[model samples]
Target: MVEALNKFQLIGQEQTRRYWETLIGSGRFGHAHILSGHSGVGKDALAFFIAAALNCKADTKKPCGNCISCRQFLNLENQALQLIFALPRRSANQTDPFTGIKEKEMILINEELAKKAAWPYYHLQIDAANDIRIAGIRKLRKDIYLAIDPGTTRVIIILRAHKMNMEAANALLKILEEPPAGTIFLLTTEYADRLPDTIRSRCALHHVPDLNWKLIREDLLQKKGVDPVQAEICARMSMGDLAAAHGYAEQDNTFWLDRIRATLNTLAKEDFVSVHKQVLLLADKEEQTDDSRQQFLSLLILFFRDVALKVKMGETVLWATQSQQMNKLFPNCDSQGAIKAIERTKNALERKVHLQLALTALFFELRKHLRR
Candidate 1:
């Protein structure tokens, strides 16, 4: 087995670590644990680590990496550790042949399907919680009744547990209330408020706060080979989200910089046609998925927000990277107009308007603001 130290990275969660140790040491390890936090806070990583530690057969306080149990666990041969993920439902465009399988029957990660699932811009639909489906729940009931495997504990890690619908949630509640012996359920969610009170009550809650900027910067510098200045900048912009920081680090910022520059330049010149064209191009690129469209709209909002901040603060702009461009463009633009445009865009997103129409209308409004 690979070393436990090598498999997991636990940083800045000393209290949570103690809590887990106490639970395990006292032998009162609850059947259900809910790990809640903001997105990109490493909650999922923590959940998986806890699951591994519980199933490990190390003689020490923690899992020893060289044991037979650890070897099987690392190889994913420990059938006791199961993962139930929220999968997108089969739409007209995409379908999974094995959609009806029970949670207990699922053993292998379908790599091909996983790649398709990871396609950017796909939103989590309400119907993706197959593990919580009536059929799935019945199967889980049966599985729980079976005797525990010797030297192994059954564990189920459910990602985005809040996505489960009312029926699914109630089913899960039943399992939580009277979970079978030697079974552990680890639930992770970015939005815990969506979960029902009854369901939340059954689980031990652990809050995972966002990673500190210092840690984020260090990780970027040491692991990603990012220069100090760039790492610091991305870390600040990410607002404690390591995932977002990593994404920013990987992205080619130059394209976005040029896009924003072009937008400002055209608006300043009152070139309505060019403005419309650019917005349409952006909307077209985002047409593949609702999530992508939302993301693109969010980026535009941030760009305009930075512009507004630059105009208001003059030399005290927080986003220094865009300050020079702001200075060059602000004199010719209307601050109130920009603010109104932002409001309209946000309103459209909140209303769940179609992506193409919303963006087209947004740019049209922006053009009016530009001329004013």
Candidate 2:
């Protein structure tokens, strides 16, 4: 069995790719492995590629994605592939993993899976589904030992593995200690240290590095068809996280950017009424207020960053297209104070403080600093 980790069309974690290629090429396809990294760093993608490669039947470059097994993996229809992740808490009387799941919850889960199938880098999320329950592991324990195609390699992927509750973690540990024949476990998590020492000791752990900003930018422009300007801006702001850059690209940033520019002028004049109204509008969305506010703050940070860059370096800025308006608003921009204020508000927001209050205080601070 040549269980080599062939290239998976990944963006750029060269070190991880080399590590896996060497391990798999040695024909020591271990029982369990963990690919750990921060969110948006392509751990899920690498795991999926490994699963596909394991079952691929190609003679030469494994995961010759056209092979039947690889196609099944790509379509997420492979019977030999078992995917596990966090789910809503099961009822006390429920024994089956799917017994107590609501229809809406199931629909949402399927939708997220579909998105993942389309793009392996897509982050899977379910509202209020915070932890993996023990029932799911018990179910997996039963299924993995059952009958399967003779040539098929059973690959079990547990995404966000750190989200496993204590009971689920213990149950999974037992299987990891003595996994069934022809079965392999692949776990991906942002916080690998959260796993018990015993569990970590049983698996080969590999760290997946964050994507380069240039790789992200090119992917946005070429793969996602994002406009060059928007792609450049989002990639520059993503801090080496591809998923965040993709999300930023999808958002209608112009709406928030216009408001930010207006808010700056309002603050400079100390127009409390207009400032209060603008903040209220941003904080009014009952469900999306957190994400909306964060997006607005991120854009504001970029705005001030451009100010500093223009003032000091005389270099090209992200919003150079809007130079006329920026120059009018920030004639003698001093962004340090304003940036500090924004960072403070951002920290408060993360702590679940009152959004409106935080925004109002931020505006007052910005007024003092940016007023010419």
For TM-score, the strongest prediction is 2
lDDT of 2 by residue, 57-162 (tens): 8875666777888888887778899999887775753245777778988998899999888777788888778888888899998898889899888999999999
lDDT of each: 0.62, 0.78
- Candidate 1, residue 136: Cα displacement in angstroms equals 2.2
> After superposition on all CA atoms, what RMSD does each candidate show versus the true structure?
7.3, 5.1
Question: In model 2, which regions exceed 4 Å deviation?
Answer: 1-9, 89-95, 102-108, 125-128, 258-290, 303-317, 320-340, 350-372
- For candidate 1, lDDT tens digit of each residue in 84-200? 555534332212323654443343335422331332111233334353444445456666677656867788777778867687688778888888778999888888888899988
* Highest lDDT model number: 2
Span of 10 residues, lowest total lDDT, candidate 2: 1-10
What TM-score fits each model?
0.62, 0.76
Give the clashing residue pairs of candidate 2, or none.
Answer: none
